[model samples]
Structure formats: C-alpha cells, structure tokens
Target: MRLTHTGPAPARRDDWQTLKNLWPYIWAYRGRVLLAFACLVIAKIANVLTPVYLKDLVDGLGVPVAVLAVPVAALVGYGLARLTTGIFGELRDALFARVTQGAIQQVASQLFQHLLALSLRFHMGRRTGGLSRDIERGTKGIGFLLNFTVFNVLPTLLEIAMVTGILLWRYDWVFAGLTLGTIVAYVLFTLLVTERRMVYRRTMNTLDSQANGKAVDALLNYETVKYFGNESYESQRYDHDMRSWVDSAVRNQVSLNLLNMGQGLIITVGMTALLWQSARGVTQGVMTVGDVVLVSAYLTQLYAPLNFLGFVYREIKHALADMERMFDLMANHQEIADRPDALALQAKTASLSFEAVDFSYQADRQILHRVSFTVPAGGSLAVVGASGAGKSTLSRLLFRFYDPTGGAVRVNGRDIRDYTQDSLRAHIGIVPQDTVLFNDTIGYNIAYGRPAATQEEIQAAARAAHIHDFVTSLPQGYDTPVGERGLKLSGGEKQRVAIARALLKSPPIMVFDEATSALDTRTERAIQEQLDRIAQGRTTLIIAHRLSTIVQADHILVLDAGRVVEQGTHADLLALGNRYARMWQLQQSGEDK
Candidate 1:
C-alpha cells in the first residue's frame, strides 16, 4: 500500500478566511466577547487619559508655592488613571477566558472525532507521531490566535489611534504626521520581514515532525530493532533527523535576530526625529516645558504597542501556519461513508454469502477474483489454503473493512451495504491469528469484548476458553497487568485471552482465522475441542493452515490461487484421493515422524 502524503504544504497567507471559518466557534460565546470588548474600550480610554493627567501635574508644579492643592490633585488623578487602566485590562481577560477555552475544546474535540470517522485506508497511510504533533500544534495555535489577535493586536491599533488623535488636536499637524508615518513604516517593515521568515519557520516545523516520527517509530518497533542487532543503526537514523532540526532551528533564530535589529533601527530613527522637533518648539518659546514632557510621555506610550506589534506579527504568522495543517487534516474526505438512509442490520439467522465477489487493495493486483461461498444458518464451513491464497481476505470482507470491487456481500439474504457498518459488525465475532492487547490489566482486556459485562459473565467466558484456571493461579488473578501487546504472557496464554474475548462477544456468527496457530500442540487440542463445542449451532467460517484441524467440519473447501478447486466432506475428499487427500497425508506423515 502507498503511504499517504498528509503533511501540509506552504499555505496561502489568507488569515482572514481562516478566521472567518472559525467564526462559528467564536460566535457561540458572543455575549461574553461583547462584554470583553466593552472592558477593552474602557481600559484604553483610561490609558489615554493618564497622559493628560501627567500634563496637568507638570503644569501645576509651575504654579505659586502657596497654592499646593492643584499639584496634589493632579498627582492623585494620574495615579487613579493608571490603576483604572490596569483594572480594566484584567477584567477584559477574565471575561473572555471562557470563550478562549471553549473554542479550544470545541476545535480539538471536532478534530478528534473527524480523525476517528476517517476510513481505515487513511489511517493505514498515516504516521501516528506526526499526526499527533500536528494536532497538538493546531490546538495551541488556536489559543495564540484568539488571545493575541483579540487582545494584543486589536488593542494596540486602538491605542495607536487614540494617541494619534490626541497629538493632532493638542499639538500641531507635524507631530501627528510623524507619529502616523512611523507607525505605517513599522507595520510595513514587520510584515515584509515576517513573510520572509516564514520559509525558515516552515522548514523548522517539518524537521521537528520528522524527528518526532522517527523516534516514535523506532520505539514502537523496539523488539524488531533488537532482533536484528540494529540498535546503533536506529540511533544513527534518529540522530540524522535531529541534526537537521538543529540546523533549521539555528537558521530560524538568525533570521529572527536580523528582523529585530531592523525593527529597532526604525523605532530609534522615528523617536529621535520626534524628540528633536519637540525640543525645537520648546526653545522657540512656542511650547512650554509641560507640553514637551507630555509629547515625550505620549511617544513612550506609543512605543509600547509598537514593540508588541512585532511580537504579535510573528506569532500570528506561525499560528496561521499551524492552523493550516490542522485544516488540511480536517479536509481529508472519508473514502467509505454510511449512506444517509442506511438502516441497522436485522440478521434473524446470521446467514452469510459472498456472491461473485472481486477485490484488490490496488488496481495493479487483485487478491480475490470471482470467489463465491455461503454459510447457512447454524452451519459450519472450513476453508483451507496456502499463504496468499485469499483466506484472511474473506474475514476482512465480512467485517466490511473494505467493500468488494464487484458483486456484493450479503447477510441474511440482504446486501450488507444496505445496513449501517456499525450494526453489521455488531452481529459478527472474530478471533484472528495475532492478538495485541492494550497496556492495561488482564480483566480490562477481557472485559473489552463487552464493556458492560458483569464479573460473573467475564469469568464464565474465561472458563469456557479454558483460561480461568491459569488466570486464577496467578496472585493478581484477573487484575494482573498485561504489558504492551500482552508481551508478558506466553503465546499460548495470549491466544487463550483472545478466545475468551471472542467468547464474551457471543455474536451469532464467528470467524476463526488461524485462531489456534499460536498455541502449542496440547493447548491446540484443548482449544480445538472447546471451539468445536462452541460452533455446534452457530454460523461458523474457519480459515485454517493445518488441514488436520478441520477434519470434522460440516463442509471443507480446498482453495488454490484464489479459486475453490475442491469441496466435499473429509471422508469423501479422502476417497476421491485428490488435493485434500494429499495435504492430509503429508501433514499426518510429518506428525508421525
């Protein structure tokens, strides 16, 4: 199978469109947002008024010493203005906290559900580590965008406007013009530099994801690397990716420093020009010392947001890039989806049929071709074949993991596609050749077959699978922790756990795909006996590699190269002295030796 290319490309810098898409989530808490905006406005007003109080206090100091009350009042008012500004800013953050947190939760939850709803093919092609990292970065991007764009970016612009208006009115047009020109230049420079830095940022992000994917893949296949004695090989591979990440990170930092230096140069030039003009006016007696101080105070206030704008600009670009990746993931369409009008499966007898079916994972190769078979209600069918003869494909087809390319799979005389996938699978139970359990307790793994099963029911199923005695012998018994993929248990023990799980499901139809292949000879015989007892009145399909295991099957099929070459009872096939007879003779001879 081809690996999917799920990584994002360099996205279009259309931040407004992305924000528009996020409007529904933001709109959900519109009331709180409006209140926050009100608080923001109050805070800015207080901030703007603070400088006016400063101007008054400076002017009041020039008054006669006998009248000290004027200067004292101005000082008090200035302090009150600063305190009000801080209070209102804090209130604004408090009011909007719910909206920001709610949006994060809603977006993360939706992305998780969307990933689950995606088709199995999509999952097969994805790298788990990279996918998870994208999700983490995406959620963090949401928080950054909401907080910075709303609070920092918007408030900065508002404060700039208030400062400009005050300068234009209280001072001359020159002061306002200089302030406005400086702001325009700073904005333009920041945007241009930030756009250039985006390339480095994207490279850094890609390298980071590659390193993470490498680490996770290596760890997950730890046993495989050890078996091959390739521990050093794996380490070198991981280090290669990390080295690339380090290089990209250094380049990213270098570009950022250059951008900061350029920004500082522009701010210094603007500040010097403004201060020189204000000093000239004071010397010419056109403006008092108080006016000069006020203009300087205004410049200081304006510089704060101007510097913040640089940080905000960079963060916004990064956030947008991260969000673009998440949105790309969301854009993946499900290859298999339920029809709008699909109904639940109503399997009264659990009969199964594969009629003239054809299938392939890729167009170049077909795995099943015109294969047909049936299991009548309460009847058993055994299919024996060599590897790649399409035995396991039948089980996957029955489970609806992939729809047949041609013809149909039916259950109870109705097309399985006519029913919802969930309901259709609910009627079938399977015990596969390989079993992988969670890194949880033994009881948790068994109870997974039926989440709501009672303790008694779980023990009964364990007894039916002949594993209850083994479990009880342990000190922890059912509560014993099963290590990753149940590696702590022997192969035979894991197989027993799988059997118990299938028994607990207790569906009307059962498929055993080499279920006893992992067990020892003695354990296989015991499990085979239990399996025979369980299949008495169930619709059973057994795919087997060992010919001796199915000698008592109600019907036997011998498949070669995806075709059913022989079909008969064990005695009749042996009497015919054909393929089945040859296979059985060979197996019995090998066992006797």
Candidate 2:
C-alpha cells in the first residue's frame, strides 16, 4: 500500500523506448490510424490553404477587380473550405476515440485474464480497493494516450514543422527562423514548467488512490461500523483522506494555471510582434497586402495548436505514469499453470490419502507437520482440533489451494499434482465455514454448482437439503432475490443454501468445514442431521468444533497444535481418557450444569 509521491523525469531515450512498448497495440489497428491520419493531414492542409483566399480578397478588392460576385464567390469558397476541413477534423477525432476505446478494452481484457491466472496467495496480500484502482487507472491510460497524444499532439507537431518550412520557402528566412526559435523556446519552457508541476500532480494521484482505498474499505464493512456505533469515526477518517486529496488538487491546479498563463502571454506578445512586422513590410510595398493577410491567418492558426500542445504534453506524461503501473501487473509472472500434457483424473476410486504432508502460510511456522492419513473409499472421517491448529489448512491442501510445503497428497492412488488443477478440484465439494452467496434468485444460487442443471434436478437437490419448503413459501418462491451476500437470509438459511449447492455438485468427496460451529444449538442440530444424510454414501471429511456433532463419525482424528495426538471412535476415545475425552468432558460438563 505504499504510494508513489513523484515520478522520475523521462530521460532522452525514454519516449522512443516507451513508445516501442506501445507499438504492438498501435500496429494492430494501423489501417484505421492511417485513415484517420490522412483525414487530419487533409484538414490541416485545407486550413492552411484557406488563408490564401482571404489574402486575395484583401489585396484585389480595390484593383480593377472582377465583378462583385467574384469576391463574394471567393469568400464563399473560403468558408466552404473551412467548413469541409472542420467536418474532417471532427471525423478524425471520432475515429481516434474509437481506436483508443478499442485499445482500452483490449488491454483491460488482458489484465483481467492475467489476474484470474494469478495464485490465491497473490490476492491474499493485496487490498481489493487498491487492486481495482490499479486496474482502472491502467486501462484509462490507453485511451488517453491514443486519443490526445496520437491525434492532437503528434499531428500538431508536424503541422508546426511544415508551416515553419513553408514560411521560409515562401517568404524571408528571418520570419521562418524567428517562428522556429519561438516554438523551440515555448516547448522547452513548457516542458520544464510542466515537469515541475507534475510533482504535485503525482502526489495528488497517490492521495486519490488512498481516498478510493479508504472508501471501499469502509463501505465493505458498513455493518461493522453500524453495530459498533463508529459511524462518526469512519466519517471523520474519510473526511481526513478527502481533505488531503482536495489540498493536493488545489496545488496542482494553481501550478497548471501558472504554466498556461505564462505560455499564453508569450504567444500573445510574439504573435502581435510577428503580425506587426508583416504589416510594416506590406506598407513599405516590400510585401503585398494579400501576403500579409495570409501570414496573419497562418499565425492565428498556429497559435491554436500551440496552446493545446501544452495540455496534450501533460496528458502524455500522465499516461506514461499510468502505463508503467499497468505494465507492472502485466509483467507479473502468473502462478504455475497446468503442464502442457496434464491429464484429467480417471475416476476409478474415491480414496484420498496424505503422505508425510507439511505446510505453512508463513515460512518457519508450519500449520500441518508430517501428517499422514488415508480414508478408504466412501468412508467418513472427522478431524477435531482447537482454533488455528491446522484443521482448515489440511482441507485447503485436499483442494490444492496450496501444494504441500513438503511431501504429497494423492487422490485415487495418483499424486494430486499429476492432475490438471481444475480436474483435481472438480471432484471435491466443500461447505465452507463462512457461506457466501451472490445477489441472485434462489434457484440461480442453488443451480450455481451445475449451471446446466434441469429445474427438476434443482428442486430435487433443494428438497434433499431440506430448504425447498422454505424456498417455496417465499413470495417469489425460487425466483426470490437474495440481497448482496445473501444478507436477507439468516445464518442457518445461508448454510442450508450452501449445503444445497454442494449436494447438487454431487462431488465424489465432500468436506464440511465447521458447518454448524457458529449456529444456535437448535439450528446446529437441524443442519447436522441434514449433513449426516448428505454424507451417507460419499467420502466425507468434517472439520468439527462441537464434539457432540461428530460422535457418529466412523473414525476421528484428534489434532493438537499441528500433529495428530490421538485417534479413535467416540467410545474408544472416551475410554482412553485422552485429549478428545477431555474436550468432550468439558463440553458435557458445561451442558450438565
């Protein structure tokens, strides 16, 4: 979450090198770019030529001028040229936006796909708000660079060069050299000032990210704020972040305005002087009035592009900053993918085994240590452990959320690593401790496990999970809308929906992770019966919290810290007077009172 304050200035070789990186996407739509470029060139040329018609009118009006209609016709012709050029200019702008939009979409899609391929470990360490902002800012850069840098800045640059060369060829070298020198000074000064101002802009961008991050974090935990009566605290914190953002914005604006005002003053004084000189030459009969008129028009036209140049340059630099962040994410090496020749598991057996497994979320502190166990096909096993003692970590390994730090886990006598990641997980169904549901119809949520499931199949699964009566009793029945994360449902209801989803998945192996640990006694008892029914014929693994709930499991492993300290059936463990017996005794004693 460290924010970048100020970016380094670009080196002499930076633009060319950076632009080379952008070239692949640019080349993809080369034909479209060329067509738009042709339109822009034609528009600028028509604009430059229009001034000649104005010059002709200024010089030829009093001469043995042709009929009055001739001058009127020439004026109309000038207007038409400007009009035509304006239309083409707009067309070029529209096409540039389209091309840029396409690039934005393409880059966004690539970034999204890359994110999906990253390991769960990567996501675990990053804030959701920060990640989202990074993605949005990165995609937006493409559109900004494509439209402003390519269409406006680059073309205006060429126009300036061409106009200066034509002035030298058509008139005195003095005028040409002066205009070139003024342009050079203008560009250099603007760049220097803009680079300074960019320091403030970069700071503002950092604050902007913080503000976005804070807001997203607060909104996601609004329920906690309400429950704790900490709304004022959250509000004050948000306001603090917002005030910082606003102060940065004000500083950036003041500096930008200073740069723009200075540039404007220089352009006004230089243009006035250039035009005054041309007029003097015309008065001395060294130049025609028409020539002076043409020169004045060219000067006016040039200033328009010149004023916009500063703004476009600023955008280009900002775009580069954004592109760098985007490229960083794009350049991240995705987690290891399935091998090229990976094969799906052959469903010959439902047996699961762990051999000398060791794992940890952080180095030097293992969660599961050299734990080896096997479940016979279609057998049931329960793992009981204190909080943070590796029960959940073992289940994660079975699903391959993380490969073992040492040793291996196997399914059907084959190392799980040998199967494609997707295929390996496909046969495992889990009812997590915290059940999550999307905002959708009840039927849709239940059908999520198998999207192509028939209505009858869905109803059957819901009935089997004992949620059909409740669902059908609702106003909209199965079509009822569940609010975000199923906030509308009770905890027990949410768990039942999850059970229904897993039942529909019909996976060969089922895992229940403290499925009833957080419920009331009555609710836990009800759900436990439903779970017992669901586990009848499958290879079931239960991570239990209440010792009573797992008494009927065929085999139970008592985990202490990171090792299996005791193992037996309920009666055997009770008779042994071990860790499990003590835990059961504590619970039973509490209940007896």
Candidate 3:
C-alpha cells in the first residue's frame, strides 16, 4: 500500500457552499420546514406580545382608584401569551425534529455511499481513525446546523427585530436607537472575536482527528505492537498528537473567555444606557412606571436568546468546520467511474484475457509491461513468479479496481470497462493472498459472499471449503463471533472461511491467489483437492508460490519482472529446463529437506 497519508484538507470551508449542500436534504421535507417555521414565527410573536401585556397590567395596578379590582383580562392575557410562546415553541421543535433527523440520515447515507465508491487507492491511504471521526463529527454537525441555525439563531434575530420595532413604536426614536445600537454592537463583538477564535477551533479539530487516527492505528496493530514490545512507543505517538490538542484547547478556552467578556461588556453598557434614559423619562413625567417596566420586560426577552445567540454563532462555525471534511470527502472525484453507456456484464463462456496490459500504481514506477495472457472457458492457468512480480495487480485489474495504464483487460471478449463495475465484479470470485474477514459471525461472513444465501447454502459452501466440520465443533458453531478483522481465528481457519465465502459466491470466473498458502501441508492437500473439483468446468486463474499445487493446471505462465518468460503445460515447461523447471526443482528440494 502506498504510504502517502495526506488526505483531503479538512479545515477550509466555503461556508456558503457547504451550508448549501445541507439545504437539499433539509428541503426534502419542505412541508415540515414551512410549517415548523410558521410555528416559529408565531412563537416569537407571542413572546414579543408577552411584554405588552405586562405594560397594561402594571398601569392598571398602579392606578389610584376607589375599587382596586384585579386586572383579570391583562393577567389572563399575560398567561396566554406565555403559554402560546412555550406551546408553539415546542410544536415547532416537534415538527422540525423529523426534518433534522431525516436530513442527518440522508447526509450520512450519502457519505457512506461515497466512501464505498471511492477508489481503493484512497482506501489504502486512508487513516481509518481519522475518517471515522470525520464522519461522526460531520453527521453530528448536520443536526446542529439544521436545528440551531433555524431554531436558535433565526428566532433570536426575529425577536430582536420585533422588540426593537415595539420599543420605537411605543415610546420614541431614542429608545429604538439604543436598542438597535446595542444589537449591532453585540453582534459585531461576537462576529469579530469569534472570527479570530476560529483559528483555535480549527486547530483543535485538526489535532483531534490526528490524535484519533494514532489511537486507532495503534489498537488495530495490537498484535504487532505486542510482538515488538512497542507499547510505550505507541503511547508516546498518540500522546504526541494530543499534546497539540492540549495547546489548542487551552488557547480556544482563553479566546472564548475573551469573547464572552467582550459580549458581556457590550450588554452591560447597553442595558445601563437604556435604563438610564428610561429613568430620566420617568422623572420628567414623560414615561410612566408602566413604560419603564415594559422596556425592562422586552429587554429580558431580547437579551436572553441574544446571549445564547453568541454561543449559537460560535457553534455553527465549529459545525461548518467539522462538516468541511466530510464534504471534502464527498467532493473527491472517483478515480474509476463507469462510462455513461456502460453495460451490465454478459459472459456466456467466462473467458478472461489481459491484452498487452501495461500498468503502474505510480507514474515513476511501472509494474506490468505489455504482459499478455488468456484463459479459455473451462480452462485453468497458474501464474508463478518471485515476489512483487505484479501478481495481485492482475486480480485487481479483473475486478476493475484500477484500469490498466495502458492496454485493455477483457472478460468474455469485451473490455471490462465497457461493463458497469458492479456487474463485472459479480462475474468473478477471488480468495486473496491475505484474507481479511469482517468482524462478524462465521455464518454472517459466509452469507456476505451472497447475502441472500440460506443457512443450508452457507453450510454446504463451508463443507466444500473443508471448514464445516471445524465450525460445527465450536460451541456456538457458525454463530461464533469473529473479533475485529477475524483476529480470534487462526490463519488457516481464516483462509478456509475465505474459501467458503468464495465458493458461496459461485461466480463464473475464479481466482485463487495463494488460496492454500496459509494452511499446513495436509490441510493444503485436502483443500487443494476440493479446489480442483470446484475449478472444473469454470475459468480459473491461480497465482501460486508453491509449485506442486499448480502442476495440474492446463497452462502455466512464468513471469520474471512483469514480463512473461515462459508459457506451456507443466510437462512442457519442465522439459525445457528453463525458469519454470528451475523454480520447480528449487521448491522440490525445499519440500524434501
């Protein structure tokens, strides 16, 4: 695997575009959005009217009259306003909850599909811990942006607008001026301070992903670490990642405290100035106690969400930062994409061909060069070479994981690229040199080869792969859980499980890539017998290191540095006493020793 781990840059956000990406998912529930918004507006309006009732109640109570009857209407109206504000506020939340959840689900599902669709090159270089953390944060950010941007931010702004307008209309331009100026100051302070604080937040995010990546990497390679006794080294590496997080987190908190102080200072000044003006008006007899009380009431309504508004704005910025990574992942173009006119694979004979295929993982270093070969229907071919002879590249090419840099790969006389990738893959089955099983039950892993396979079919495939008897011996049988990457099972057992999975697939073309290499000699012989039976009447390609295993192949291709050095039946190659004969003699000597 290529070790260049530089992934997409995660911190930069075209905020407008990133937020716009979420719009469609949320807008898919347009009816709910509109109704929820209407409820929101009504709730804010009632919240604004709440103070108006207080003015009347205060005036009625302050009046000097013979009979001081209770102001029942004002009292009841005040209660109703509060009730309306809360009830409708809750209703809005109830209505929009589904939209929030649905958008999150849709976005998460799309991200998952995109991740799967990404090329193997990306997967090979991907830091699993980082990728997983990005996805988790991004999904969470969707919910926060959807709920708070609409509910918290918008409502606060609407309430501000209503309260300022009421102050201007009820009293005079001076009161409104103080209210608007205070809002402007508060918002400006928040935006400017929060903008500067963003660097700290972004720093925290970068370090967090890196730290998580290190932790996960260490854990996944647990056995390797134990073997080397590098537990301290791994811990030090993870701690190194977190040290930067610690710095940034401290700076983030410091900046936040600065921001809060600035906001509070502006709020205190604004509140005092407004109250002082109201006091002067009351003393001058221009404003009654009712008006002063009303102003105070509206101030409470405005500033409560207003304080929360600052926090909401900060959180929204952080949310955008989190989502930027996931969206960047979404923006990553597929290295291999289906042609617009791609056809489903249609193969009657299941013949496989590599036509002068020249390929490379990188431009500086080529792998296969004009290497051509073919396996006719119901025929088997074995590829043997020293390590790094481009053995795996051929299998990947057949699966269309990466198109050859030059030349073409054909399945059933058609360029594999002409067929949709999924369809082409459906026609081929491979048991790779390294079998990585899913962290699931034996039954689940086998069934994954064909998800619709019944228990009977699973058992039959297991028996064919010579693993059913062993599985039956376990107390849980097929229900036994394989731990992460099937680490709980031995190598031979994992190989058999892989074989069973491949058998369950029952594709027209089969590739056994060192399929028996992991087993003991006796087990290899037994599984090889079953493989020979299964390969009958099916096109098969075997990439082998053990020469004896492939002697029965109808043809053998000897590769030396990505070029075909010899090709003939096993007897013919041995008779020539060339590369294939020498390799055979060497392996025979090793076996004898």
- TM-score for each candidate, following the candidate numbering: 0.92, 0.89, 0.97
Tens digits of per-residue lDDT, candidate 1, 342-414, equal 8898664588888998988889888888888888898888998778888888888888888899879989988
What's model 1's lDDT at 474? 94
Q: Which segments of model 2 are wrong by more than 4 Å?
A: 1-23, 66-80, 322-324, 346-349, 591-593
lDDT of 3 by residue, 1-593 (tens): 12223233344558899988888998899999999999999999998998888888888887676534545677888999999999999999999999999999999999899889989999999999999999999999988888788889989889888888888887889999999999899998899888788877777777788889989998999999999998988887777768868888999999899889988998989899899999999999999988898998887877788888999999999899889888889999899999999999866559989999999999999999998988998899999998999887889998989999999998888899999999988889899889898999999998889999999999999999999999999999999998999999999999999999999999889999999989999999999999999999889999999989999999999887888889999999999999888888888888522
lDDT of 3 at 176: 93
Stretches off by above 4 angstroms in model 1 are 1-17, 65-73, 346-348, 591-593
lDDT of each: 0.86, 0.81, 0.89
**Model 3, C-alpha of 479: deviation from truth (Å):** 0.6
Ranking by TM-score: 3, 1, 2
Model 1, global lDDT: 0.86
Model 3 residue runs over 4 Å out of place are 1-11, 64-70, 591-593
**Candidate 2 local lDDT, 425-522, one digit each (tens):** 78888888898898998899999988999999999989877789999999999999888788789887888788889989888899999888557888
Preferred candidate (TM-score higher): 1 or 3: 3
Kindly give the number of clashing pairs for every candidate: 0, 0, 0
Candidate 2 or 1, higher lDDT: 1
